[model samples]
Target chain A: MNEVKKLPLQEAANCLTPALRLAVDRLPEQTARAAEELRLRVGQPPALSYGGQETALQTAAVTAADLREIVARAARDSVHSYADSLRQGFLTLSGGHRIGICGTAKVENGNFEGVRQFGALNIRIAKPVFGCARGVYEQCCRGEPSSLVVLSPPGRGKTTLLRDLIRCAAASGARVGVADERGELAALRDGAPQFDLGGPADVLELCGKQDAVMHLIKTMSPRIVALDEITSAKDAAAVGYAANCGVEIFATAHALGLEDFRRRTVYRPLLSIFQYAVEIALEEGERICRVHPLKEGAPC
Target chain B: MLKLLGAILIIGASGALGLSARQGLRMRIAAIDSFLKALSRIESEITYRLTPCDELIALLAGENDPYAAPVFQDMAERLTHNDGLSLSYKWSRALREAGPACGLREEELGILCDAGSFLGRYDSEQQRHSLRLTAARLSAVRDEAAEDLKTKGGLYRACGLTLGILAVIVLL
Candidate 1:
């Protein structure tokens, strides 16, 4: 990989608050470059996810105040704007790094209002492996414009692969609209994507997934609509609507395997919508485990 | 000639001290007003942009007067580097650090420091409520400062001149 396309380790470290930034900066260059996530908890030592292994930072133990400061920095000190994300248990920073927060849940009117007294924080670094989806793209989008869903367990390269596939489709002059619900897909800043999402891609960052899919269909006239991590029945229904409207769809989901995917009732409707389900496994390296084709009129 | 020169030196020194005392009082009032203006800006920012406190403070520090700017600017920088200090603690520290530069009295600065206890610790609605309360209390303090500047401000200058004149007569 060219140096410019390498993981932005230095910029990521600079984004952290000073104390944590110092700890990350002190890491060996190779470790820093390979680092994937920075996990911190109240009254516990900080840890880094390096090459999929958790390594503890040999610094002072994190305190409640430390967690608050990190939140302040991540939210840019405006917790109000991030309240929705806080209720959803994560906030995506400007560079598309997602910070998962766990704390005392504050519920109001049968819905999560926000979090308070934060207990833990997980900073998931954004690593876009360029051209990793060449196999998946070639396999799924062979003849006709078809809908595909990439599936994997959490921390796998589902998002990474989906992004590359979108780029591939866009490179072939397909108009793709990305529903970047958490800004992780496009990592847009100042109305421009921080990551290269091919040439003919339009992104809507931080909007609701279902709404974005519908909006993309109506306004952007995109040939394909892409979403990240469909988690709800509503999102599945939206994908079905987009598919019926003659717009191709691409999405990612967290599941172990086909059996596990079938067990989840929320994604039942989606099974009929997608032509192929590409399961990514990280056994030896990131490779396609299975590309299962759902039979016509499959059980929902 | 020697006696006259000595008298002139003492009188001049005392008169200058008195003038500065009056000027200090006026400056104290001006500083308080500037602080109120800064708080108003913060309220607007919270209500409208919901900008992050650190970025908001840095922006205010750049736009506000030097006397009032340091508090917000210093807090923004310090919030990032504090060795895990709580928000309230950092807010108090910033007020104290900028107290001398702003020329605000301990009691006056205390009003601001007290508001720091609730800053960024609650929901947006609650934060807005707290800021409004703090701004109201600051308005009261500004009124008191203005009263002091009008009443005792002249008294200090007159006392200094009178004392200087009395000392000169005794020496002569």
Candidate 2:
């Protein structure tokens, strides 16, 4: 597979207010490229997060208007259209960058209406490191598709790995079905995926993960099914059912390692479904993927 | 023969002036009616489809309202090819520029500018509320314009003809 190009940080900065955008632009080219997330809070200077550290942009404190402008721009001046996603506290931009919102919740009878009086925004820039999954793919999915789970605590490139793995699987003549619940993995626009997930892959975007999994399994008849962040019992049940039907699963979970993953009661049921787990860690700003075999009934 | 020609010219010019005044009133009424229709369509789109401001403006531009359609088209073009400006700015600017040609009064234009401020800055319910309020105000303005056309239209025509006849009689 050809190398996938990295999206520039300026693409994410375009969503910021003019002042914040200028502050980010003033950063050194290397720092801007290495940046992962842009953080904005009301009455605070904007900051950039990279290498598990945050560097504040020295400028005027972010105002309520600045935050609102970011939200307005991110929604493309259509706040009503993104009401559902805003209620869930995030809006996915065109290039797959996710903007996490913080504000007063407008709840009606215990149901979330949406957000109001915006407070802060975390714009997580999506840097799709295309070949980052090479080591995991070679170890876990060489000859035949394998059911493997990517383990990481947050921001350790779990989603990035799953995206590349899906691409790798699809390139190898396998029909891969992606359950992109948050519209993050595929970032589909006009029926075309923004991120290259290979030609043979089919994406079901903006649907719940469990329904997407079952729906893909039933309709697409995919050889491999991929999902990001399996966080619920329903999702585990769906993954288990898909595995039972002889379809390989590639998924990610929030865990430090296999032992930490096994300790979580909610994800205990999923352990039996995955044959191997890949744990991602950052050492001196370089990502290291450690693949471990999960023998059923193996001691923790 | 020269006196006859002069009298005819006086009457004809006065009559034309009356007709022009009546036409201006009619045009105002028509412009108000078109704006009312456009506002109603906007409310429906917001309440039901939750269409984005740019897309909604583009849709309105495609409509056949002679007065409002051009303004909507200008706003749509600006929105489509945005240059990092806010929607409120684009919206107000478009209306301020094209609104006079639509025969909209300053008060009516003010209402439209106010509506632009909140066009896409809130959720569906808030947006619909703002649209409905703008429509209500425009509707009142339209009713007044229609009443003016009804009451003063024939009076202007008659006064113009009477003035022309008086001028001819004095000349003779």
Candidate 3:
């Protein structure tokens, strides 16, 4: 039985050993002797394997039902029916626990979803990755209501930074409202956030960022309205609305450099509101070096 | 003498079979993980890449536009065929319905659908060939693993049966 009392996402992720045998040892089994459980264990794996052989098992975890749960929760602003939603394959849980799923993708009546069948599951454990936002905290929150945007090359740690910011902001009493559209920010399962997202002044887990920003501005009255990735013109416009409403906005995106940021016509309007930006370049050395100020272009 | 030789062979085969099953499961899982990672990279790229594509498309569609609509044409013209995700049409179809944020159009999905039909035939054919090759390798490995498992269990049962026969022989 799990510790139903406190759903510790970090702790659960920590227990994921290198292979099957190690994982079972971590489990609290009702056996007379714990070591005896290992030898007698017939079908279980030897260790929690991460690389090579274990990769196949990892992929097996991403089922469509798991996708439905993650996606449904992210769209929490409404009542999602599994009937129409395309629950991809799997969603990685906090600390590397994988959830699998299956379902037909709900698309327009005539249109087909690229994501079909969705009948496998692998909830890769997503550990609460720390030490990511060390440099950006002070620069992001200038004395006045400030807006800072983080740019990454993808797979670099944009969400990791956002998660840390949530923790940092909540600790600082900023009344932050996070609009996690992808259920990645505050991974809450079984009615509680598994990741340490601080105490939420307010959190709209699965709500669209643009819609949530408007709703939070009108109702929640948060000091800062945060979001994950700004993908479209509507989303960029919403950031402007948040700024106009005097609510600071914090978010992440993928881009090469300042030129790439400006070239984006749909997201261009957002540059005016975004005063500061930190670029996350995914290299071994100089991974995160320079901070770019939109007020001052490239040469900085 | 024959029974003893069979028992030795059984134990040896059992260990090898167990190892092989573990390896096969691992290989398939790795492929899936890599496939997903590839998909994510593509998604992130497509989202950002669409802005420029949309601009180029808009300009081309507009008679009084500059910078050439070749960019838009390029998107539709590109030839693709990958076992996991080579079809641009599959991606295009999803984007059309993914709301304004994802840049998918429900009306234009048919264009992608047609492209998918053509592209998918080749893709499926290639995948079938690849799977056949992989399946052959996997089958051999599976056989070895099964043989090993059978031996372990068989040894225990055979041990009991042989002992019972020996007792009967002595009693007679």
Which one is best on TM-score?
Answer: 2
| Candidate 2: tens digits of C-alpha lDDT, residues A273-300 | 8888999987887789988888664322
RMSD of 1: 4.7
Regions more than 4 Å wrong, model 1? A1-11, A15-17, A28-34, A50-53, A78-84, A259-264, A282-286, A295-300, B1-16, B53-102, B106-123, B129-147
Cα lDDT tens digits, model 1, A2-88, are 666435555555446578778877888788788888898888889988766899999989988778777865665567656656767
Largest DockQ belongs to which candidate?
2
Report, to 2 decimal places, the DockQ of model 1.
Answer: 0.35
Give the TM-score, chain B only, in order for the candidates. 0.92, 0.90, 0.29
Q: For model 3, how does the per-residue alpha-carbon lDDT over A1-300 read when each residue is reduced to its tens digit?
A: 785542332233322222322334344433212111111111222223232123112212333333323332322211111212223233434433434343454355766532444333233445455656745765656444367788877656677788887677777778888776666677555346666777755776656677888888888899888888888877787788889999888888777766787787876888888877878775654467356777664223
lDDT string, candidate 1, B100-148, tens digits: 6778887778888987766665557777888888888888887888898
> Native-vs-model 3 lDDT?
0.49
Ranking by DockQ: 2, 1, 3
- What is the DockQ score, from 0 to 1, of model 3? 0.01
TM-score of chain A of 1: 0.87
Question: Which pairs in model 1 have colliding backbones?
Answer: none
**Considering only chain A, what is the TM-score of each predicted structure?**
0.87, 0.91, 0.67
lDDT, candidates in the order shown:
0.79, 0.85, 0.49
Q: What is the TM-score of chain B in candidate 2?
A: 0.90
- Estimate the overall C-alpha local distance difference test score of candidate 2: 0.85
